[model samples]
Target: MEHRGFTALGGDCELFRIDLGGGTLAEGEAWVRQMHDRFTRFSESSELSQFNASAGDWVEVSAEMDALLRESLRAFDVSDGLVHAATLPALLAAGYTRDFSLGSTPTAMPPPPPRPLPELLSVRDGKARLAAGAAIDLGGIAKGWMADRLAERLGDNCLVNLCGDLFARGSGETGEGWPVGFGDRSVLLKDMAAATSGVTKRMWGPGLHHLIDPRTSRPAQTDLHEVSVLAATATDAEIYAKVALLKGSADAAKWLEGRAMGWSFV
Candidate 1:
């Protein structure tokens, strides 16, 4: 069985149970909504918006916010800065100031020089802060992270797909693993997760997307059409898949093995 609903992260939240018959779909929607309320960029009063507003100031945030911040930071490090979360400035400059479905509003301002997120992020106890002129957009990872987190609330035979990013727990009805169709082939997932990232989904202007190249503060010009990765968790899949897609081909392969993410594809 499958259930779908609009997500706070600008995509649909899809909950599926292999065997069906679980009365958790509504609860899963609620969980997804709760995460959206806290993390959505569309809401000015959301926790993430508050945190973004407090840039350059050490601000108090919810425990959930702090936890996700650290996770984004970890993604930043593991991807060698290719998958940086602090690309808000770049995104805004590219006319992605609002949701992609809303159509682009051109902005000519160039983004400020890119900086490593670790240099700007400071998280201690339950408080977090960013350096002056720094901002972070968790849209890069929150969907997958929230999917992984919500999977714990689901049954053993469940799959969570936040937009195209996916996570699988127990085996589906097939009894072997969850069948995920990608391109010309498919993969079985058991006690694992997968995610796909590409520049095609949310493009604006000539070639603008949430995936920004730190070296130029512009959308990365990767040659891969898309990347799919099955990993230990949704967040890891999101991070590594994106990194692989951004790197492209031989370099992406070497990067994945170097990072011990041999399951990633592009």
Candidate 2:
């Protein structure tokens, strides 16, 4: 097995492949860096930043951007508005204006009320547009999307783990599956994906964190600190994990009854 590790998207990233050479690992690393440079919300010159700045006007987007925009819309529908991409303004108002690694100071201002994603964003004819006051931070959805893409590009048998959003493809060296760390134990995952979502990692104060509840447009006040989920794809896993966390312990289990292959909450 060949392995490569690097830091990107505000956290550690790693890629592993079976029956592949070092050059493939290097190429994967480069692609991850390129995606980070293009979509990172912390950089003003990034494509995502430029789109956020041009709210209310139609802006031409690359094919990659178009696909991601469409995925964001799909995420909204699948998660039932729980996994919103256009929660950047609410996140900023909650004092998550910078990358979590650098730390943040809480603000006293309240976030604006939530709005439906369909009402706030539209994509068509190689172009995309945001409503007058709407802005988006792709965040975990971008990571999950990138992981899935990287796995396909890496090889038939590979695992791409960008931060905690990961996709496992093909069989392992022994032909069982890729050994992945779940909540407290290692699980063999084959042709599946997993993602973890939480408020504990990024919290700055009593009520300040990055996981904004689209229902209230505030940092979610949930019983569980974190939740991990398994699904058919990294994108679906990401959406499931976030929705599970936001639903809190009381309702999370019932809501996730048949949605995930496996799940753990803490």
Clashing pairs in 1: none
Q: Please give each candidate's TM-score.
A: 0.91, 0.96
Local error of candidate 2 at residue 179 (angstroms): 0.6
Best by TM-score: 2
lDDT of 1 by residue, 1-266 (tens): 56556564677667887545454877888878888888987779999988888889999988889889999889988888887878888888878787678887776676765788889898999999998888788885888888887777777788888887778889887789888876458888888888888878777656666677776787788888688776788888889888887787768777777443335354
User: What is candidate 1's local distance difference test score?
Assistant: 0.79
What is the C-alpha lDDT profile of model 2 across 1-266, one tens digit per residue? 88889998888999989966323989999988998899989999999999989999999998888889999999999898999998888888888888887778567566666589999999998999999878899989999999999898988889999999999999977799999989988999999999999998888888888999887888999989989999999999999999999999998888888889999888
The C-alpha lDDT values of all candidates are: 0.79, 0.90
lDDT of 2: 0.90
| Candidate 2 total steric clashes | 0
